[model samples]
Target: MDLNDLHGIGAGWWSRILAGFHRDAGLEPTLLELGLILAVALAVSVPRASWRYFGLFVTMVHELGHAFAALTTGRLVKGIHLRFDQSGAMMSRGSGRAGAAWTGFWGYPVPAVVGCILVLAAFSGWSSLALSVSALLLLATLLFIRNAQGAVIAVGLALASSLLVWFAPAALLGHLTLALGIGLLVGSVRDWLNLLGVHTRRRHQLANSDAHILARRTGVPSALWLAGFAAVITACWVHAGMAVAAVAGFPA
Candidate 1:
């Protein structure tokens, strides 16, 4: 079959399957979404071994967010851990509510912005240079940011997407972007659900373990910080002129 025919079949199958699951378990739709994301991730990652480096870049971004939060609030970074398998930073400053909120909010966007730039460049026919530049930025960001979860995800996503564009056919880029967008939407929903008190064992564990650390350092409640981060992220989408309603899963 032709590419267009294949795409139509794939999309139709996915849509029907997702719709059925969405009507059944409600939670099953999320699993479907996750599966789609994993498919896309693998599609982009399986061509080469260098793609694993993207994971390291992601770890850096995640840790960098933590480090930035510490420094912005006048806290000192005691040490940085940039392990090939894991990445994070240690800081000595007490976290204030505003500082932590802003740090968390900005962490993901920074790397996402970089990714978008590289994607744009590659699409504009600057593939070689863009790939090289993006790789460098990813490595540098990973090295610099001490504790940035969002940054790590962003970098990893970018790296995977970049590699796909480099080695894969141009036809796949649109599909990859769609997959990434869906993944982000799922993530946004997951975050919102956590904020809404839907308790899972993992959620409870995270709350029990990290809650005190956050509370002791940043006098702000976690809910409020999450709200602030959501607000900032929403505002960013608004400024980008995309339909904020779509992002929020509301009618535009």
Candidate 2:
């Protein structure tokens, strides 16, 4: 094998990836453009065909949120299990019920938090940096993947992210990031709706839900936990909306 075939990424590509770290021109979306982006985001997130693949990325992010939160509390993370069906679990050893509650809380809200960060980065001329950093972080999660499917998803996502960063021009990266950020935000809402359906329609699946788990552990009703997740996700949407609103004048 040619030495240039290093992990499918040549040595020169390192500079291309590293070079994205610097800020370039920021693109502020017009009201009409913001509406269009939202529609495109919804197209991917709301459609089942697109969601079947894209939702896996959201699930990966969800599980990583649990692991990151556990680490934040000094918990020892064991491993992560992810499936093609978009289900996942993160194992960790930790003390303190509060810590568990806190960790549990993050799984639902983190995608929205990340979405807001991406949107803000797009508006601030850091879209390339955001994409590169995020892809590297996704690659880092490979260390914690315990199952075959999880390994595949992690590697697949990292490669996709890397390719996007490597090939997308700086001028267009902001629009792409904005669309991605919006997709994540929309996906978060869709997942939340599915969880809500689990509680309201499919009570049998409560065992697999974060809110129910929180309620069982904290003695806080599941409704309240769900509310907490909604609150955070809503706040992220509001913040991102305001950022768009600042630049977007009256819609034509």
Model 1, residue 22: C-alpha shift (Å)? 40
RMSD of 1: 14.2
lDDT by residue for model 1 (74-138), tens:
76666455555433444444556666544445443433333333333323344334433434445
Q: Write the per-residue lDDT of candidate 2 for residues 75-118, one digit (tens) a residue.
A: 99999999999999999998999899988999988889888998
By TM-score, how accurate is candidate 1? 0.43
**Residue pairs in candidate 2 whose N, alpha carbon or C atoms collide under 3 angstroms:** none
Q: Report the number of the highest-TM-score candidate.
A: 2
How much lDDT does candidate 2 score?
0.88
Clashes of each: 14, 0
Worst 10 residues of 1 by lDDT: 20-29
Q: Which ten residues in a row have the lowest lDDT in candidate 2?
A: 243-252
The CA lDDT of each predicted structure is: 0.44, 0.88
